[model samples]
Target: MKRLRTSIRVKLTIATLIPLVTAIALCWVVGASIITSRFSSQALYTVETSLNSAHELFLGEQSRLSDIIRLTSRLPELAENLSTSGPTASVAPLRLLLGNEHLSFLTLVDRNGLVRYRAANPSFNGDSRIGDKIVSAALKGAVTSGITVLQAEQAGRENPQLPGKMVIRLKATPHAYTSSKTMEERGLFLVASAPVLGSDGKLLGAVYGGILINSDNRLVDRITSVVFQQGDTDARVRGNATMFLDNIRIATTVRDEQDKPAIGSLMSEEVFAAISRGTKWIGRAFVLKEHYFTAYEPLRDLAGAVVGALYVGMPERPLMQLRSQVNIIFSCVLLFLTIIGVTLSAWIGSKMTRPVRALADGARRITAGEDLPDIHVDSHDEIAELADEFNIMKHRLAIREDENRALNHTLEQKVMERTAQLEEKNQQLLAAQKELAESERLAAVGMLASGVAHEINNPLAIIRGNAELLEMTATLDNPANEEVETIIRQTDRIERIVRNLLTFSRSGIKRLSLVSLGILVDDILDQVGHQIPLDQYRIVRNYRDGEIEVEGDEGQLRQVFTNLIVNGLQAMEGGGMLTVETSLNMAQQQANITITDSGPGISAEQREKIFTPFFTTKRDGTGLGLAISYGIVTDHAGEIRINGEVGTGAVFTVVLPLRQKEVDELS
Candidate 1:
């Protein structure tokens, strides 16, 4: 009896505790996933908000600097005195002007790319660092902006005498001042530059001015003081933020801790590369042996060229400590819940086991073929009722066994019939799904075909008009001949368009061959350039020196380039610049060809549907250009990336892997 009771107790205990344990385990897993996801999302939001704030600050500073440059350029005495008195005489006034809290070092570079004058104490003298790209660009009436690690000689000081002297220079055209001369001799530099126009609206020169970031300016001190302030009594945290001009770290509150100024320290390769690529980055970085979450953005001058990068960083340790504290609190709560659940399960299991064990023992006696024994129950409960039922069941078992078998057979037959019905319904559902897919495909194809047909008709009309003009002027072979030739070329382009349409509509892989990209791009440009209105737009090509070869269908690849170029032209309805660049992406082992357009950029919502057939933003657009181009590129096992900002313009980059010799041979 005791053995039978124990068996029943074990079964009941397992039944009660298993489900409770499972529920607690599932709850823990779900809770952890939710908390982790929330934490990650919040972290990303905080970073994005901080970056936006930093971007606004950068823009404000840029505008303020531009204003200073404009105001200072109008000062007639300063320009006249500096120009006529040679390089040495300009130092005193420059030093006085730079004495202002916001002004940095003053520089005067000539058109021949020479730093003719600098304002640095007794070391002020004329130095010629001619043939520099910035000076050349400035001479050509363009603002040259970029960050560079200033060497001792390139620091704008004549003697290189000033210890740890570095400056971020903005070179611009000088306005019409009394000392105004040629574009080269009159080039001005301060911090920022503004174009100076004469009363007659004639171009004169540019004026430049800048704030000295490294000096004991109150602005820097104030920002640090507020953010690093601790409790009362004027105490503060020992933290600092520094500014880097070019690759050189110039100004910082923490400079005193270091043995030497960080003014000439070269930026890390990663940071330099990002700035060069015009990309802004924000993340944790180790600077001066301390980890900081740094917000970095490229600084641009009036011409929208990146001159320098601004970095605002705060120590990451404090934020990490806070995160750790949160994690600890969460872990403790989870641990407490876990302990409670385990304890409750143990108590409930013990309570359920006793009655279950009694029933189990009674069942075992019947299995042992003993005369049925009456079960004695301590409590009048469900278990006691079950025990009485078991005794009755054992008495009637021999008589009811045959009837039970027949009932089970009938249930099995019904289950088989229901299973067959479910299978038939599943097949019908699958067929419907297939038909829906086919309908979607046909809709897509129809839209693409309609747009392609419409786009081709316009060019076809132009071709026809040109041919008629040529036919009428057959006898005249001068200007009219040239006009006829131009017409024939346009007609050929229309034919190419029709060919691309047919290729796109028919979905089949074409034969590919190993082709040199340099030659391929040149050939496509020769054809597509004639189609675009070149007078309104400029095409800037930035292809690498070496051959970029890949396995692809030449005709199909030509269609892809044509489609992209046409799309870019269509985007810039009012005419703008188009930049096509090619380079090897070493990490990805692919050649990246990027087409950038200086037009209103694509929105995020629009970008999602850009490759979909027949989706277009333009009234007269066929939209199949991008869709067909996308298909061709995908067929070649390549990836295409489209990225843009609303006002900044758009870039479409295609990455195709380099073809191996073996694969090329096989093709």
Candidate 2:
């Protein structure tokens, strides 16, 4: 049991190291799949982008060369010299057209797809026929342009000597000579055909133009530069483009170990099969025993036949090296964290046990009522916290023990002194209490008598003096207005006392009458702002239908309006707006008087019992305003409701019947 308890270091090792190992394993398992999927997708995107670019370049060359052929085919020499001067005499003009352009193949062919004039290989003007699809389409007066692979023997040149590019031409129908060489094999060429017409649009002959791509070409080199060119050599994004004829790479920028053009090399079996089936193959491929991110697109001929493939690829090594470097960094960081965690955990475990053991021993000593010394711990860890707590407890215990010893020594003297002090204080307290009792009795009687006499005699004195002053100052013709005002003020002071006592003491049966809400509200506002400045609040009056009359007691309704408006104004500190809106709801035939204030609103708890009798939130309040208001509203066959939450100020909505039909019938 001791061994198990003490082996915290081992426990920490197993606890920390296991998760690290699991994490490493998890990273190893998932990292390859994620990296491969993401990097491969990026590589394929680049390749596909390059392939589409190549297709555009190919079409551009065809279109530009087709325009040249159309312009050339309309020449008067082309139609006149074919029969009179014969086919061989036109080679100079055809070669001149090919001179200023990058065109590789330009041949004057009759409508039957027979080559009449050849610019490059002009010496072999034999009666050789061509089965080139673009030429055949041009023979039918259809201008065509496309990519096609020609056999070696058909061009009368060796495989390496073939022009590595081609394009079709456009022309009208003329004629074809019966030829002998019909089954000759040819190398790859992109060709264009255009119909040649006389000045009057009559079919004359068709012109065929082509560029050879069966050898290393500048077109593919430029494509490679444009698509995958990057500045970094160490992490270079190396790319190669190829013109593939079905399975064989006819012309490519892909290089062999001898730094020769990797021409005539076969595409991978998988890529070839997919391309043969007209599928675009984009994935990782092993070319020249090195992996590449390759994209292959099926090349279609003039007749829309799948004849070859266009390919673009970036070397896979750089991407792989990037992944490997990332993996190495991750492993180094993981190892560093694991080592740090294990070292920290081990140090903590070793340091922890000693303090815990010391604390346990100290706790045992404390249980036996033995003195304990301070426990010292320097590390900033949980173990140090525990030690600190123990030290604090030990210090408190020492203080208590010292107090106990001192208390034991001074107990008898303390009792004697305390008893003497208590007796003295008791006699003094007894005399003080008797005098205090007499004072309290006299204070209570004096306060009551004084308060009653002051309250009653002051008002009576004011009334008597004001009356005497009025009597003395009055004249038959002229009355002293100041003396009359003093009399009126004294009477009002006495009336206020009576009013406060009588209000809400007993619920008075309200007298109902036809009342205009606007008139009642106006009267209350004029009376209430006597002390307060009315300009402190913006009074917004919105009466939807003017002069809304409700059947209610005039005095009671006035009191309700007075209480609500005063309360609303008082609720707003530093002045806020007050909205008094009246609307007659025709559907319910009730008058709604909404008195709202932009004030620090009533809370939920305050609103609940706001109308409860004698329930007030104010320091000096009668708490009878809303209660009396509620009673009056109910008696008038109306409903008074306060709507709003804590923050949105209070809205006291009084909904009263236009004519209290129920109450009126009863009356």
Candidate 3:
């Protein structure tokens, strides 16, 4: 404290070390950040690309099966055998092809959607596949292929070996959705179907085959081979590929602690939920007992419903090891450079001390107002350069001061722009919330309808049963006979209404059959008198020369046509003409049934919402009739069209496909 003398060398040393240490720290921090970001990005990209590759492989399997089935269906000999001797004669050729193609199951179905032959079990035949989506589509002249989940019984029916292979023991998994079952007995298959057509272009039948994917490692191994290309002896260092049926791993290349394929292990709940919502999940996730960078894409059915997921993941350990190595190398380099910097700073500080003392002495002389010659340094050094740079630094500092003010002004404008963007985001959030609310409302409605239908069905069945007993017990000429009959009829109507509600809620068709549209319309017309007062209205029928038949659920089609006919009759409150016409569009192989009502028509807005559930114009209407009808027609691969303006009366047209064969006696 005598004078607090600080040497120029000390000052110069501090100045040199301050910026050197700061720069080294910055380089370390920035370099680590860049390394981590690049590695993470590359990891994510690799996982996503692997997922895409796995998806293509899955599709490639389906395409291969599709080609096989399509080519098999085009065989003239198979078609001739099917048409002449039926599935019995065609089995030999099919069995040979089945073995050649390595299919787990191959079936021949007639145009009526009935399984006529089974390559796996020749004795098992004549089972109806009318409810099978792939077979039904194939019968309708479409070649179809997709990943399908089959019930254990259905899989066993295809091939007895399939059930055993499909059975996977479920293991306890972390962060996965829990299942009530201990094992997944159902089979997941890559299935393909094609229509067997005659030389004249007529649909003869359909041929369908499938390869079971449960416990199959070939596809996932192929995906890994193609995507990773690195044949590592260590399984942990290799990539993982999995195909999930919902949340269950039906096919996978990932292994468990026992070194067996984790076939039945479940995926994380977060990934499952994301894929369930039809969104891709790409990020780090915990798989099994380890963390991994994963990418998952939803695997959809032919109907576009998210049925499962395709997943690819890289082990986090390898990536972490790489990052750790990079960091270690950086740290070592940083430490070495730090040591060198300190040594150089010490040397430079010693060199500058002499020159700095000379400058100090000159400054003191100038301050004392002593006239002196220009200060001279013997060597060209940093101190000599600093003397020349002082005036330029002063000018640049002023320019930076002005730039700071302009930057502040620009930042304020940017804040305003950001505020506007935030407002727009808020508006988007509100819209999304509104959509969510609407979805919730629809879900609630479905639950209510289902509950109501269930609660009403038991009492309804009892009432209808008692009413039928009373009708049967009473004499035909008795005074109470008509009343009993009416009671039974009215109870039946209530049952149909309940059925409509149940169908609308579940959106399912119970059974499929060949229905004659003309006969169905006539039957509804004959029965309409009991339900509606048709005394004031004139009904006209314009049916084709012959009955037009279509493949559908008879009861569902009855409901659809009855609803349309009844709606047409009721629309004419003032007693107008109701016309029903049926025709065939041979080119499209479709039947068109048109119902025209000569009364007030539907408005454009109402028409748009007409098929939507719970939207009705009538005061006493349940608003589920058209909705149920629409679902039924769509399930049957048909459509309902309304073509009429306000005040012009509504014309309802129902288009349905013609059945290629008689499906009534298929069973």
The whole-model lDDT of each prediction reads: 0.59, 0.70, 0.80
Cα RMSD of all models vs. native, in order, equals 18.7, 18.5, 28.7
| Weakest lDDT window of 10 consecutive positions for candidate 1 | 179-188
Backbone clashes in candidate 1 total 20
Candidate 3 least-lDDT 10 residues: 658-667
Off by over 4 Å in 2: 1-6, 13-36, 83-88, 99-104, 111-115, 121-132, 157-185, 231-237, 359-667
Candidate 1 vs candidate 2, lDDT winner: 2
User: Which candidate model has the greater TM-score, 1 or 3?
Assistant: 3
* lDDT for model 1: 0.59
CA lDDT for candidate 2? 0.70
Q: In lDDT terms, which candidate is top?
A: 3
Segments of candidate 1 deviating more than 4 angstroms? 1-30, 75-95, 107-150, 154-163, 167-190, 193-272, 282-295, 299-308, 313-339, 356-381, 390-667
- Using Cα atoms with residue i matched to residue i, what is each candidate's TM-score against the true structure? 0.42, 0.49, 0.52
- Quote the positional error of residue 230 for candidate 3 in Å: 2.3
Across residues 298-362, which tens digit of lDDT does each residue of candidate 1 receive?
Answer: 75544566656655555556555655676676666666765675676567666656666766776
In order, how many clashes per candidate? 20, 38, 0
